[model samples]
Target chain A: MSVLRKSTVALVAQRAGVSVASVSRVLNNLPASESIAAKVRKAAEELGYVPDAMARSLKVGRTEQIALAVADVGNPVYVTMMHAVSEVVREAGFRLVLSSTGNDPNDVVELLDNLERGYADGVILSPLRITDEIIARLTSTRLPVVVIGSLPQGVLLDNVRADSRTGVDIAVARLKATGRKHIAFVNGPVDTVPGSARLTGYLAAMESRGLPTTADMQVEASDFTYAAGLEAAQVLTAQATPDAILCANDLLAVAVMKVITSKGLRVPEDVAIVGMDNTDLADHANPSITSVDLGSAERAREAARLLLARIEDPSRPSETTVVSPWLAERESTAEGASRGKNVKARKPELEEGVS
Target chain B: MSVLRKSTVALVAQRAGVSVASVSRVLNNLPASESIAAKVRKAAEELGYVPDAMARSLKVGRTEQIALAVADVGNPVYVTMMHAVSEVVREAGFRLVLSSTGNDPNDVVELLDNLERGYADGVILSPLRITDEIIARLTSTRLPVVVIGSLPQGVLLDNVRADSRTGVDIAVARLKATGRKHIAFVNGPVDTVPGSARLTGYLAAMESRGLPTTADMQVEASDFTYAAGLEAAQVLTAQATPDAILCANDLLAVAVMKVITSKGLRVPEDVAIVGMDNTDLADHANPSITSVDLGSAERAREAARLLLARIEDPSRPSETTVVSPWLAERESTAEGASRGKNVKARKPELEEGVS
Candidate 1:
């Protein structure tokens, strides 16, 4: 306990009769022989070497820390994106600070206040739904911020957005190619930006295909949770068992699949299931769900790059970048020759029929 | 833009010639009269009212902010626990601040330093592996901290621990009951606290059941990741298709399941699968995975209670509390009399096991 007072790796190395680098290597588990590692380990044990990270951070003028705020971290897509972001940030010599706002505009405001005081060099925010007031407050600060979603018009900022409209168009086109006329769109809350955008995209795609979307074919869930999705699916399935079902997100798609399977319905054979956000769960599901890759890794990388740029120069004119989403065909959709081809290469042809 | 600054419920109430409470009710759509609701809506539009969260946080001593620091935020179990913790904390008037250290000890030190800057009133930390130095540093601090996993021996601190030993015991017991003589235990890094604990637990459970264990039966993965689990499973499966496989965590189990399925084997029928951490994925997996419920909600509640108590009375004697884990039987485990009961009803009998 008394050894904790020094709080230096050098003191431990000196006491152990070894170089500081050797001790550090052992602590970090770097390559070293058993004998040298043994000695360094013994030295560290005797001296109680607790490294002073604060002193190092202060000296570096960079805490190697970045804050990430999301409307909900529970969403599998967001969780997958966070994992990628953390991996890249760690590789780039930075720690990740996470915050969840529960999709509440006020929660985001509270998080920003703490972010200002958290000593993080940069911040990445993924607001569930964007509002003018939230945008104004975010833009008020010159702090390095990279929004993971689109901002409202007139509020310029560094952003990495997912093109869900194109994603929905691709899903509809694939379903249409399978000769599925009646397609049901199960949505989350329409007030949410993604929900509204996906619903609008679904309607536009249906209209472009010269297909009439009956009111019964479109249903909105109270929330984005699996239970909500299941309930929405119940209503949609009751109206008419469409040959194809398109979900706004994977969670909803998963629920739809579960309900469809429970009723002894075969996917693609009885009903084609397509989900947005090709999360890990989609790959791990029973039938290996077909989904649209919203480019989570790309979004994360772009956000990190933008945040770095903003941290380097806060006064630069704000910019927004949009990443395209592509369809990932799997067992959920009907197997065909177009299944394995890269969706991006076929995007133009697919969009022509749907958009 | 000027109108946006003046947009608030108070302003709307003032303009509409109504009480602030009435404006709030109308804005919330809580059974307000058509005339008053219309008037309030028109006034709110005219004023451009948006609630100011920053001003509110400043007025309250509590920013409603709590920080959670984990070795890895990307892990599904941690993500689920965070979601549950956030839900609870939000209900109790607190927002969560998340920080990931990528399982690096140095990052933990950095997180502690930043915590002292008063960004959050309390912190919940989940270190990947505990060392003496970390325990000493954490115990020395007067700040309130609730460690999500085990701490060092003889250190009096508030703790929320998962009973991995019991979880392992149940898993092994079930496999043994299913006549799995050649049981294999796949673990992550033994140097890690969980790896070490679960390994010891597996050995102890085997010994108690009079089951012979061999060195080949115990395989260690590089890390607690999906790829590592797959690689480890390939080794374990190559030797013999063990009647049952018990994984240290759910991700490992999912990976093992994938490998087994790819090899043309069915879960439970060919190879029984059991994993710890009954995460959301467990319920949604292909066969609906069987897992151990580590009482995450209970652990969270206890951790919060202990932290608040410590904050209230730092001079009080420190304590350690262990939250028990239960076995959740799903499609992975073979259906038998043992699997008929609900998870809550059957508690794994804990025998003397090394920590």
Candidate 2:
């Protein structure tokens, strides 16, 4: 709603010599006495009074549409999440609508603000970035929101988060099992939430292996894209050849594979590759990439379940769910058990619960 | 809104000896004559009058959201369409929301019915199935709708269509140019619109080449999925081997590649393959698959534009746009000029306009 210097109907009521109800009735074009309506309108015009249009729109009858907002719609992880969330939301008798909130925290805030329009009963937000403004909006938003990623400490909300540190450790352990002595981590920008967590995981995993965990062992890409991965992998290859490389995502893994092959090196033979976010890209990859399944589908399902539960009873306590990660060992790792060997394109894996 | 025998305020007026306006005023909690208000309220209680909840929710105030409904959100084609649609709608100062209406025509009809709640100003529909019920809903919907796929001949709405026949012809002609006499067309369900049109194109191209065009030369998958393609391709290979094959979509082509390679046949050497839609899977495929670019992004952009135009002026005549298809040559076809060699992840191709 647009505001004109805090002009309100209450001010019009005072000038009109009438009650606030009379002012509201006149402003909303509801039934009013002739003299009272005329006096209210004249006073309102003098004060330049404008109602809060956004607040008015917020008044809603329960529309069954539930919104899911993600940073990048193109990411296969989100696609997996979307597919799962769609299924659960549909089963619960709510239509799922997806909103792409680009990689901007401000855009996320704006999206949350617009949700007050009440088209959707609730939203499942998987924001890549979190800002103070976003927190402010989320804290104040009347719509039920269940976040699908990490949140700042102390600001309580229903959240579903994956164990990225453990995800990286699984990738590292898988590579170590194949006797890869020189393991290097290829990461996206360390400034990002996932990027930073993954880098920390790499260091922790190396320590667990009783190997030297240094900054030099990790290379950073500008972004989590195939091109950026190629550029960063090129840099890592020039510095020193590693027997194994852990990519942050599937696209990065594909790029690293292309680079390694172009340099006359074979995957899992000369250099084993492990990818994060066991997306379809990893599944369909040639000699399929070994990746960490970070429970994208599980996270989405839990988030949707939390949202539905909260919608059923908004008084329910804010909850935080940690979905565990698993290793999807494929042909990309030497002698790895491969799901790709199956002719069926997709198989939903059985998940185990973790506290 | 729950209906109680179509009881309305008019009926309350007749029962209470009050004006319809006075009855409405009382029902809506507006100002009315004291005796008339009491009488109307009593009549309403006796009649069990209930309002239309859906109709009441249909009242909108120019909400900025525009919805795009697609059959499958997992398909890369829809992802491409969604990305393009999002950009255009955002540029027009509107938020793009996605609704995944499943493959059922009844689902699409129900979606259209629910859309009367007026959350979005307009919609861009890309339905896989065309049914009478869906057509009726589209025709009668108050929300401005633009279709992104083929509609029935007489049923008119703002429409955007791709030349699937032309897309297939280019693939067939390309294979023929490479001196491949035995060309087989691998398709999804022939009952589908694109499936039927592509099959016709294959026959026409074979006729143009003065070659036999028969059911024996073509194979049909149960559905447009990698597993289905593998099942159908296995059937095709058992009967007879074709030197070149044109697939309905990228998944099928990828599956065909796997089948051919499993039989110790090299791609573009012994069994050349071409896929349609030119999705990311085709781009990133090993020895990347040559594919028909069906202009999914273009179709979406045109669909969004048409809907926006209609929203601006409801009286504007319904329009149709035919986006032409092109070929993205890669290593899957013999002597095919490759674009996969580019290191950059994505490079949008130059588009030629078609009337």
Candidate 3:
């Protein structure tokens, strides 16, 4: 139970024996005599009265707080983005608030409603699913917002996104350079923006390289999860053994790598693998999976910068910043036996002990 | 360009042709006539007058938001805790706002100031360095807060912590049970809470096992990062090779494992390793480093639960919940040559191919 009623401006005024206007002026640091200010301050302190951030926010029109909403924080990719965004926002002298939509549609609706209610000065949202309703709501919002993912055509807003098309192209090109003619594309659900973009990019990249595109060689995971990637890869490998597999994300690539290796396949030697979103996992993997760097940290930093700009000048023309993608080659796609030999030599030491 | 000024309660009242009290009654869903409510609702809709959540929060004395302050989200351990805490907070119908103090003393001070200003209804914090000043401030906080770390003697607050002493004891015991006598303890900075506790635990466990705790076997990392771990390991190994090494965290263990293996020493056979905080990285490591499960997820969930309970009943006595720790055995502590043979056999097939 609340120990006492929350102290209000009127309560402070009553205790200070002053007018409500005088109390507000003193508390807000408006033009007030030293005596009046001291009296108000003493009264507020005595009554444990804190000028509510919310109430002051209503009068000031800015909370000095920015909200960064993402799909999930459990995913390492988003975790990195969150870290980068928080650092940038904090350095700008703004308190950062984080919210995870948890892939819930209702959470998205609630997020829009909360933003409209002025809980934050500005917002940076990375929506997993884009819908007409969300677009309509965002279009009419009074507060400045920056989206961290791809938006539909003609939906105007400040956006910072990755070049997933280029990311997938880089991964495919790396596999092709390793003399892998028969390559398979393993992707997450087609409904997701990244999933769909990477899939289309894979097909285009393969076609551009004069490589055969077969329906049998394309596999879709249920989601961007390790288990889903393993299940999907098992099905694809059972049907046909491609010389190389391009995964949509790092988690999928690592899981696919584990599956292939467990089935007695060697990376780079039997089937080369490449992942996208060059996360820490990509580097930590046994073969250190080759990955396409989509610049997650840069995307988040740019998104925070864009939102700050919009907050400062709401009338400025909206801009879209796209971070470039590049390939990071590691042992996963090494063309020699030296790297594979070392990994194999180290493997038995672990297997004999525990996992 | 500028669109228009934000609509106010007075503007809505004017448009509805009703008193401000009536407009407020209709908007707040207090007592109001159907006709008056209809008129106020129409006026609000037409003018796009979104009720200020901040102002409403002052009146209701609840923001429906919870703050979670962590040291750094970039650390995978904190990321895991954040995910669990966010899930619990969201399911409880409260918004979770994250703040990373970044190991800055001023940031922690600012956090207390912000909370005192009524930024959120409740708070759950995981402080890296717990000071007496912080404990004093928390003891008298007007808002409900739960700390996800150990508290000092006689200090009272809602707290949820992992038994790191037990966690370290289990790791050291397991190492000794596997015939490893020359044990080393590689830890982060001793100034931090986890660092000091884990260090104490290591010494106590060693003493209990009758293992000689030599100065050469004790190494302190500059920080918890992989680079620091590698540097500390390089220094420790350079002095003398320990048969087994117990790390304070997974990042250190992984880095040290790389260091040990690169030096031509086999894991378990020459130098076994055990890490604390059984994060995903532990399992993903090449020879999957054995680790201590500190139950970070459980601590977060318990902290959230305690904060909710305190919020619901502010007069209730503060409670301290401690989560137990367990050991997760992996490949770094394995025994024998049979597993190594199979890995060697798989290496040649990939080498013969294009890779």
Best DockQ goes to which candidate? 2
Sorted by DockQ, highest first, which candidate order results?
2, 1, 3
**Window of ten residues with lowest summed lDDT in model 2 chain A:** A346-355
TM-score of each: 0.74, 0.77, 0.78
User: Candidate 3 regions off by >4 Å?
Assistant: A1-61, A338-355, B1-60, B335-355
Question: Tens digits of per-residue lDDT for model 1 on B197-313?
Answer: 899999999999998888877889999887798899999888755667888888888888888888877776666788888887777776778898888777777777666555544
Which of 1 and 2 is the better model by DockQ?
2
Give the per-residue lDDT digits (tens) of candidate 3, residues A1-355.
1113323666777898876656665654545679988888898889876656423632344466788887866567887887888778777567887787766667777886765555687888887777787788788888888998899978789998899998888777777665667789899989888888998899999999988878889999998877788898898888876878899999889888978887887886677899988887787676678999899999999998888767655778999989999998888888763322323323343223221
- Residue range with the least summed lDDT across 10 consecutive positions in model 3 chain B: B337-346
| DockQ list for all candidates | 0.40, 0.43, 0.36
TM-score per candidate for chain A alone: 0.77, 0.76, 0.77
RMSD of 1: 15.0
Cα misplacement distance, residue A82 of candidate 3 (Å): 2.4
lDDT of 1 by residue, A253-301 (tens): 8888988877777776667799888987677676778999989888988
Report how far off residue A126 is in candidate 3 (Å). 1.2
Better model by TM-score: candidate 2 vs candidate 3? 3
**Per-residue alpha-carbon lDDT of candidate 2 for residues A1-355, written as tens digits (9 for 90 to 100):** 2243224545677899977546544554445689987897787667665444412432223577899998877778888999999889887667888999887888888787677777788999988777778888887888899998788899889999989999998888877665666788899888767888898898888898886645655899988877888898898888866777899999899888878877877776667899999998897777689899999999999999999777755667899999999999887886543322211212233111100
